[model samples]
Target chain A: MQQKQVLLLTKSIKEKAIKEFYSKERPTTLCIADLGCSSAELNTLGVVAELIETIENARQDLGNGSQEYQVYLNDLPGNDFNTIFRSIASFEDSLKKQIGSNNFGHCFVNGVPGSFYGRLFPTNHLHFVHSSYSLMWLSQVPIGIEDNKENIYIASTSPPNVTEAYYDQFEKDFTMFLSCRSKEVVPGGIMVLTILGRTSTEKYSKESSYEWDLLATVLNDMVLEGFIEEEKLHTFNIPQYTPSAEEIRFIMEKEGSFILSQVDVSEISWEANEHYYKNDLPKTAFTHYDFVKCMRSVAEPLLVNHFGESIIEELFKRYLETVQVAMTKEKNVFINVTVSLTRKG
Target chain B: MQQKQVLLLTKSIKEKAIKEFYSKERPTTLCIADLGCSSAELNTLGVVAELIETIENARQDLGNGSQEYQVYLNDLPGNDFNTIFRSIASFEDSLKKQIGSNNFGHCFVNGVPGSFYGRLFPTNHLHFVHSSYSLMWLSQVPIGIEDNKENIYIASTSPPNVTEAYYDQFEKDFTMFLSCRSKEVVPGGIMVLTILGRTSTEKYSKESSYEWDLLATVLNDMVLEGFIEEEKLHTFNIPQYTPSAEEIRFIMEKEGSFILSQVDVSEISWEANEHYYKNDLPKTAFTHYDFVKCMRSVAEPLLVNHFGESIIEELFKRYLETVQVAMTKEKNVFINVTVSLTRKG
Candidate 1:
């Protein structure tokens, strides 16, 4: 899903956001910031290369020979900045080589350790901003959700207040994210945000409803086996949300800092089908294991922090078995939403 | 010398540089960058705290209650940033407590891993810049001085090219430093640089002459004792220089980006003299040991890299005995020069 979202950026967003910003501003130093830039350097550096290429093309069009880039890779303090910093010297070396050093735009990389919920950069300091698979993470789990028992996210079995509390937190967090970026980004700046979200047509929809059900079911299975405490399961809630496209549009309207230039919504299948495999492949395919790995990469840290590390292997084992049974009869896909915005003057 | 330079900042540099920048710009988020912010969290954070207080006090003087601080702590990419980053959370917590959090100026700290010899920030993005004991480090060892044999620096017994090579490197490095900073700092921005320098009156001064000679002396002693190679001792030259106040002033004039507003020169004792000794300490004093430890902190890594790790224990052991003998007959003090600069329009 993220790969497709990145592809969307290369086709549409690269042309609109960066090209427009460059033609309008012609800033000698084009400053870009990547919010929630994970420890994985490949994804973050790929986006940077794309943005730089867009700027390079724009400069070539205008007969501009000179420009520099200052990229701020931001994340929570615990993110592995050392790994990224270690990779930068070589990253810059290759970037210079790929686009001849003499003609290429000089690039500077920095790590800004903080949350994007509040202001990160100084006023009118940024030319472009981006976030990928990061905005779904709320500042925290929603308040007044104590009765959201035995479930880590909103579900069909959840009470009405549970959904309301989660949405309330999302509205506040997404609004704050927009308002903060408005101040940091220059007028006519651009921001491209890719969030996992449902289509606006799904009215009264609980996004990730069945996904949470399987996770909760796995925890209950463990509870029956005397592995995890029932009380712990009752109190735990994922500090995340999957909003509808309409909910995101509403936040932008309330914040009133950015014009929604474009939004694209598409569903991505969770399981890889047999179409890609060759005839010689193994027969007892663990198609469901792929889903477990994907979900575990996102949720393992939170679970380990909340429930302790001892239950992880058993928890995932039970989750894999449950997902295998569910995969045959049910459809599972993530709603990938990409939105591009222009900072209002 | 560095400790005194930091003290000078608390008394004079803070009031002149930060206060002037704050009063002139009235920026809501005052940006400050510390070039060569070493891994010592105490020293870097101390400077940051002083900068914030200066801005906080300036804001208070005008009855302004809202302000934010964004501090960029810069160092070479190889620096031990993990230790400093690990300490920031508690540091911020204490800072917020020290100044009441309700209306105190919010502070943001970021680590920029790079060399300061080139442009680090965006054009006109920095408000104030400062570096302590950092500018004395030349970008590299000057070329064509392989004949300055057996000695690590310019010495009385050395050829003329050795002195000329060291001075040439210092001038080029310093001028480049100024020009690069001029592009990044805003017009009327302030910079306070504390360099370990000579008093400028001496026509043939060899700053750190005896110090490096003593180190060379120790290395040669090891070489004679069959512990190190003679070829290695002759090939190594320190990638550092201590310029006189006059030389520094000349570079600023040549760079022509900053106006020299104030200059103060002071000498700091290299050894712990009688004045600092307590009543109950051991009588078998390692007074020369103080200088060895200080120099080791700065040069140990370079030594270990060039000569291998095996020689360090024995080399320093000989260095202490040589320094102890030299201390009885010589005067050793570091000449500290502090210059305040304002970026010219």
Candidate 2:
């Protein structure tokens, strides 16, 4: 998923971050941060590497490649930072190959272990901020949505009240996030966010519901088989939302800290990467295994904490088969919303 | 050990960092770092907690209390950052108790995973730096000391060339460390370093040799009993050194970036923390179990990496017994050397 998003960052880095140095005194160090940077081995640094590469290219064009970098990689405390830290030596070695050592000033990478919803840095510190597939997540599951029974997220089966609860929560949380970041970023610092959202013009996205509805179906099967308690299933909801472009724009205006510079809506195929699948199943038009693995990474910890560890294998297996059926019935794709913003003094 | 050194930090913080803000426009944030902050459960944050507490007190004295904090907790990548991050919420809670919520601004703690031997940050960024019981560790074991066979560290029986090699490595590494930090730390900013060292008038303290000799005796016994290889024991040297205050001063003077403000020598009894002993080994004169456990955490990773996995349980068990016998024969204590420095422009 992040692989596709990597290309989107180059434009932000080249235009907003790199080009600014041409007109001003080039700082000895460039500080940028990636919020909600979930670690998955080497793939976690892909965005950071792309950010540096773009800056280096632009630096060469401007005839100076001597600025240092202070890169902050942020996520929740439960993230696997060890894997990311262990691979950094190799990452630096590879980076030195692309930009020669004489031209490359030191790139000091640090991991910020915390939530992005709150104040993650001191005021007016960061030069640029980037969050990919992160901002749609609420600080916690929405209130008044406990009755969103049998469904974990906004779904066709969910009541209209449940949808309302989710929208209100998104509006409130996104506003808080903007308010916090407004203080952390310098007056002219820019931010580019790539969110897993509903990119359509409609208020309710039918295309996005298939993913969550399929997950609910898997849990329902386990409940019928006496593998899970009905009460536990009723209370479990993912602290996530997929917001529309208008919803985001509305919240930013109400927050009144940043000017929205760019808003892009795009569709990404479900079978984005064939190699991401683990099993050697015969390749099919619908990539159920790859999608299942992706969802498992996001959902496993929550499920194990609530439903116990006994049902994970069976749950994801059921989810894969259910998704297989749903994809066969209709074509589906993830909606990505990429927005760029400039801090307003 | 860090508990005792926490008092030494208040003076540095109050005089150097806090007093400066009185004359200048109060920046909304304060940037500081704790380098080589080895995680020991909740104890890891003791120094950091003290740093913030002192600053808050000084801020109140100056009649200003609103300042955000960016605290960088740095250590080698192998350090247990997970434990420290897990306990941060409680640390923050306790901090709130001390300072109260109205005056207690946000403190963003970040983990910097890398070696301090090279450049860790960009030029003139950090306002303050603190390292405790960390710089004594050389980046790697000195070359040419493989001939210092059967002994893990500086010992009476090692060849003179072996001692020279250790000294040379320390000088080179210490100078490199000072040079790199000179760039990272802002001019006129201060540093406080508390190191485990030999504080006696004699260059080589007889007090320190009991530790390595006991470990050497245990390994020799293992080799004789055919439980360990003789060749492997010869190559495994702990990449550690205990320098006198004179050696530290000489190197700092040669490095020429920091002005040494104070060098205080103190002695810590072997049984500094009785509860640190994991087992109930009845009351005794020496804290053998506590000392053994401390050595195990530091040596286990290096030992396991070189000597394989089979000997660890046996090695520590034999090590404890050896330390038990040595302690009864003589009383011993750890020498601490705490120094304060100001970065020069």
Candidate 3:
């Protein structure tokens, strides 16, 4: 769903940049990098396939159909690279069937395991970079937010200091990210990113923080029932933040390594895929099960680390009930921010 | 021993090229690739360390002391990368002790698991490439040598067709090698290789083929004693060759992608390190045990694939006896050839 939205938002810019790269750079072998390319949804390669198709189309249109591609799938060191490698043979075969074996043979894919915050490729080697649904994650939870014992993330009830900590951390991390990428990307290289952001400039907006508020309520109930320690809840904070457009632009401009080519903002309903909302059926179709499942996959590591593995199922069960009740009262939506930038010479 | 000799032969050339690279390219991040870098000796990183030291010294001399390095250690996919990664921490620490921590932090080392017969990196990314004592092994043994049953490699006793087949295979493999590296290395990049070669123009010279002749004698004895089948021996030629320097020059010029910078040939006595010759001791010191052990490490896989596991110990015992007797009769030496080339624009 995130990929579909991101692709929809950046379709024109992506196509334009690919054509420009073919006509201007004229690189016989184009190198591309996909950062934070996790294999959970099995759609990372789909993104690479789309990128390759675009380049192939542009190359053919420009009378350079023989250009080769070297695609790198990058993720953290602990990601499931084994599964990715195991699936590569079939993936290549399918691509060959789609693009014809002669053209498909020009593409080579390899896994690069590392953090995106550091330099992973040779300088000025990459021509195009794509990242989606990954930059919102801070390297770690904002420092000094421990005193916000009742909340797992920035919330309306929290003091101003909590929000300030998160904003400062994002500024530091995003600046470092742009700085590293500036060195890796070649002159006139293009980078497209889809990130979680808030439409409102206000830090305490309910649309962005309410999901965490409901999750906090679920964990509070668990603590009251003696399912987990209150201290563990107090010590744990989610290593995620949704930035505002102003915040993102501020960092990009401050870093001054790239020129923003385009920025688009769109909203996704929290209950966008609920059966009741999709089919216009009765309210009985409304359930938080899907939401709980999706959020659990993202947050399980932190939950398991803090509360142990035994209580995960029960915790999420309570989370589903809490979210189901809160969803009827508030129609929360998440802001999706897509930005395209051209690397400076 | 091979590593030491290769490094000694290329020391002056490597140093000179590094200095020229610093003055000409002035790359802030130097990329170096070491192909056929197996971890069997646990000293592949030592080679990288030596390369880094040379580059660092050159950079400092050119007033570019802050330049960083990225070293790629490449080998077949079946290599023991776990051992290499396990030893990397200590390797980095030792490097830090030698060069200050600030300088050590500038170097990054990674394992690239793949064959050198194809592309393993981005085009024009590498500045300096080194390979040693590995190019002699063809991807597979030459076809049609199956009919030549008396020897396991090119030998004077073998049919003329057998020598032709081996030579044809080397030409194919070496041509593909140069073609691939030409695309990967940047214009003016330097590649230094130390390959096993023969000094004589004759394809079946005793200097290169006598080792296999003695091994064949050992295997024949095993067949006579009913320890192994004679038919298995006939089909098991080693996938290796020692090309003449002229043959190498011919292929390089034919490929026409690189200019020959330097070529040197040297010979090492077969018994150079044997205790008998080192100390002028009695015949009791005439042990082929070291030779047997070294060859077994290299040939065990092929031998086990042909002969059953049960006969390995007995086969090597006979091999030791055969080598000891041959050493008394005929002194043998191996010819080592080192060549340096510059990639053309």
Candidate ranking under DockQ, highest first, comes to: 2, 1, 3
User: In model 1, where do residues sit more than 4 Å from their true spots?
Assistant: A1-11, A97-105, A200-212, A271-294, A317-331, B1-5, B8-10, B24-29, B62-65, B89-106, B200-207, B271-278, B282-293, B313-331
Best by lDDT: 1
Cα lDDT tens digits, model 2, B53-138, are 77777677778857788888888887778778877878888888977747678988998999989888878877778877888899
**Each model's lDDT:** 0.79, 0.78, 0.79
Error of 3 at A262 (Å): 2.4
Q: Could you tell me which residue pairs clash in candidate 3? A: none
Candidate 1 residue B294 C-alpha distance from true site, Å: 4.0
DockQ of 3: 0.16
Worst 10 residues of 2 chain A by lDDT: A2-11
Instruction: Evaluate residue B6 in candidate 1 and report its C-alpha lDDT on the 0 to 100 scale.
Output: 46
Which portion of correct inter-chain contacts appears in model 2? 0.74
The RMSD of every model to the true structure, in order and in angstroms, is 3.6, 3.2, 5.6
Winner by TM-score between candidate 3 and candidate 2: 2
By TM-score, the best candidate is 2
lDDT per residue (tens digit) for residues B89-184 in model 1:
788887777665478856778889888988778778788898888998999989988887788877677677887888898888898899989988
Q: Could you tell which candidate, 2 or 3, scores higher by lDDT?
A: 3
